[model samples]
Target: MIGARLDAVSEIAESMQTHRTSHASVLEMEGADVTSSQTEIHHIIVSVLSTIGRSPDIQRGLTRIFHRKATAAEFIAVIQAILIAAKQLQQLCIIEDKSTNQQRETLHSVLLRKLISIASSSTVINGAAKLLSALNKEAADRQDLHNLFIISDGKFPEVAEGTRRVELANEKLDSLIVVHRKQLRIHKLEYTSVAGITHLIELPLNTKVPPDWVKVNSTKKAIRYHSPEVLVALDELALANEQLTVVCQATWNSFLTGFGGYFAEFQAVVQALASLDCLNSLAILSRNKNYVRPLFVEDDEAVQIHICSGRHPVLEAVLQDNFVPNDTDLHAEREYCQIVTGPNMGGKSCYIRQVALIALMAQVGSFVPAISAKLHVLDGIYTRMGASDSIQQGRSTFLEELSEASDILKKCSANSLVILDELGRGTSTHDGVAIAYATLQYLLEHKKCMVLFVSHYPEIVSIKNKFPGSVGPYHVSYLTSQRDVNGDFKSNEKMDHISSEDITYLYKLAPGVSGRSFGFKVAQLAQLPVACIQRAIEIAAKLEAAVCNYTEQQIRRSCSLSHRQDGCKNEPTEDVLESDSLSSGRVEGLDDISELYRELFLNLNFGFLEEHGDDRRLQFLMQARNLAAQLIKLWSSGKSTTRDLWVGHTSWFEL
Candidate 1:
């Protein structure tokens, strides 16, 4: 129902005359015309059509009327609401023509005709006429009539009799008061009313009163009494007032009951107004943001999403001009899956989210934040992003991740738009890679949906090789400086060695895989301790070297076994021969080099190195170079594994 309403509204917005009017100009005109009543009326029409689209009274009244429990005031409110909408529609037709161009006059005429048709709806007209006829003209003219109940009583004789009785009782009470005053012979003697007491006679303390008069109260200067006749008249007055209230309520209920037959018609008017409100809101959004209407292809067409220079709708508003736009192109017949890779905070998630949001906005019949967008309507949009776990549900983060992935695999179809960000990140590296790889393979080969897959694992990009043109590898582009702000040269030995200080995020997408996520740079940006960051970098480098060494050792062991199995008749492969020579040249003393290095530097005071004078730093560096020279010389001459040589040379250096 909402989608259908939005579709109708979007169609109206696309064909509206206000599309050509600049929102800025409209704002300026609105500001300049603040004092003009006509302009104020125009603003009212716009507000009614846009912001105040829904009428709660009309909806609730319809329900109450259907249940035979509506009140006269509720019926009055619903009728007045519909009548006001018709008034606003007429105002809109006039207001719209003032800004419409000559070339669009015919279109404007057609639009006005439609508005006129709604305003001239027989139900609205007859309902309003009936309401006006039923209400007193003077009461109807008041701005607030919620409490006004001055309806004609000719049809309700009970109310008429109640009113007449109350009037006669009041006259009889007044006549008795006059008679008491004359008999007391004191023109000033009058009723002394107290809380819940009325028509009590007051006289001087020394004066005498009738024996039938009941003494109500006494003060130092006066005595008060209630006359028997006055008490009887008061009872009559209370009864008349109570009876009048009951009959008036019944009369009002009867009045409201007359409008029940037109309940459907009133509801239709309110719905039309609500829809017009939505259409006006969409028109305003499109004009203000300079958003273009998206073109949707037929359902039978090949599934495709091709957006040019699309911006994240919400981020663009917050960032204003600083927001960067990126293009998206996915075709089921070609590359339907994109493997997105980039450093943290490089806009990978933002890019994929933008595409999904644009697709959703387009399908909802709203203009998209893009240069242009054209796509086949998607069946569904499935997203698996962020990390969370439910403790009460007995699910860990990894379990939750896999559960959503499993659901997506089960439910998503070829026409679905799937966005999976950093899938399998909660598990071990090898397991994460395997899971992410298998998931992408399934999505590509089985579902074949349009997928935007984001991951920190570079190995995931290798899936493109298997799928060929079906998979595309892309990354958020960035720039890196060679030196830090302090003129310290950045390390070049590692591809991912760049620090946060040396990196500049372009926030734009580009083709090719990013070898590193540069998470340490993100750590630096987050202001982690310098010592902690340095230690992490060192540990990462060590792990990389250890993995490489392990691979080399495995290859050498396999080659040696193959050679032995073949009886050493055939020459070994080039890689095996190189490994053999390198292994043969390994100095046995180097076996303890790792332990010696750990003892020397594991607890080194990095803070001391940073804060100490250059003289002391240079001396410490010289000792390090001396130790390196001794190790190189020892490695040059093959010696059996021993700790004596390394210990003897490093004995003079303090740990």
Candidate 2:
């Protein structure tokens, strides 16, 4: 029996390996667009069954299951029962895509039901249930029961159930009777008369079912009700010194049909699994690295890459009601760093983390939840953006931040992306600012790493001013004032309000810095005292004043320097020049006016007109008259018309 089991094991292994090899070939060609892993596993099971012969029992069961004769729930129960038997036989059962609704009837469910039903009925062989019932009891004085039928999947049912079944059996004759699968020892108890006992069933397979067979001695007495031919066959087989008996063609056929049905199911599953692009490829080259640079090619240089508006897949699934999608833009000019500032509950952390996770997912060969993207390739991503402590490692939250930040700074290169949120917040304000300042300078001067840093400190905004065009500052905007006619501010005070329900975030990214932290407001909303809010405001005011003073001093110094280098001048001066008469002749009314002016000047010279004043005065009067003539001419031909190019009219202003 052990040798037979070994042979079966070898056969199963070889079969699995062959199926796996073929699956690998298919997967290598499928690439990233493959179906999921569960689908692939289902495919493999179907394929394997196709290679093997289908059993008739399995066919019958499948026919019953598929035609809706059996409900899916009942079918699952039946399949579980067969698995229970096979377990007693030391067989393996792997069901993939079991819980899916797509396929109404699975092969394993169909096959197992048939086997269990057949094994329970009698052509000549005793039913496994009936046999176990008889064997579990003992005949105290008589030696009557002799025959045994053991059917098992090789696992044992729980002891409590088995004990109950044992107590239920009526056959008597034992100091010892049942052989427990777990203990591998026979149970010895008081014996009852075994004069009428003839059949035994042992179900040592699954933890649910009873033993399928019982040991029968040749010296035991036989009853007249036993079949003569079965007794003769057993005697002959027993004479041959064989520990295990062979099943006849009829029984073997039944098993093949039943088991083959399950095999077909297993094959279907395997084939389905193999059809998935990822799993198939994995089957072929299981050693390959898990890195995939997505096909997000940037079409236009000017288009800002929006990792569109997307939710983190894992986070979204977990936070079904509370999940809010965030957007990211990677513009070429704002390449390296993006400093994001926002009030509390504005989703700054979620935005940064979602972007990092999306990038990671893209590289890991999964579809990203984005409307569209033109992503640049990133080799690695480092994040020091969240707070967590490792007390076991004797590390505090600040220590963890320092460790993560140091690692990020040391390892990040031009292609790596880094995200740090409130980097120095766990420490003193001055120390945090100093560390953040030094970190920014190091990233700017030493490495061209892409960074998205979220912070409340206004000092990071100075990076945008000092390193012009290197950093882009984005502040999440909020409506400043909200009030009703009663002069009370509207607050999101309801504690029962979930993150998703009635939550409104402006979500727009604006330029410049946010003015205040609403920490005290949030505390008040959480039922804190008004004095606490006042104290918070006072502290905030002092900080704001200090920052304003520094900025003012810096502004004054720069303005004074600019003022020295002819920098007080605001507008350009233009020089006056005499007009060219020939150039001016093209004017419509001015042409006639110029001719009239010349005539007047000549008439004055020839004494055809009376001079109203001295010669110099006459010349000045003529010039004034010429100007008036020009003005009158201009008035006469005022507002020259304009025609479109389609009308084919050329104008003085035509290009």
Estimate the Cα RMSD of every predicted model relative to the unseen true structure: 12.8, 26.7
Write down the TM-score of every candidate: 0.71, 0.42
Checking candidate 1 for backbone clashes, the offending pairs are none
Please list the C-alpha lDDT of all candidates, in the order they appear.
0.69, 0.47
Stretches > 4 Å off in candidate 1: 1-44, 49-81, 91-122, 125-148, 153-156, 185-192, 206-208, 250-263, 484-501, 547-655
lDDT of 2 at 483: 49
Tens-place lDDT digits, model 2, residues 1-655:
2222222222323333444554556467553112223233334433433332232243344455444453323333334333333333221232234446343222223333233233222321222233233222232113211222122443222323333333333222121233222233434322222454443323233323323323432223331222233344345434432212222222323433444434444334323222332322322222222122234544443323357566666666677646665567765456557888877777677778888887765654444556654466676888887789999999999999899999999998866778888989999975786688779778877876778888887655666656678788787766654445576655644222121123235655666666344565566668777777667667766765664464344234223323244542432111001122212423223345444444334323322111112342343333334443444445466523211221232221121
lDDT of candidate 1 over 349-383, digit per residue (tens): 99999999999988877788999999998889999
lDDT of candidate 2 at residue 205, scale 0 to 100: 33
Q: What is the lDDT of candidate 1?
A: 0.69
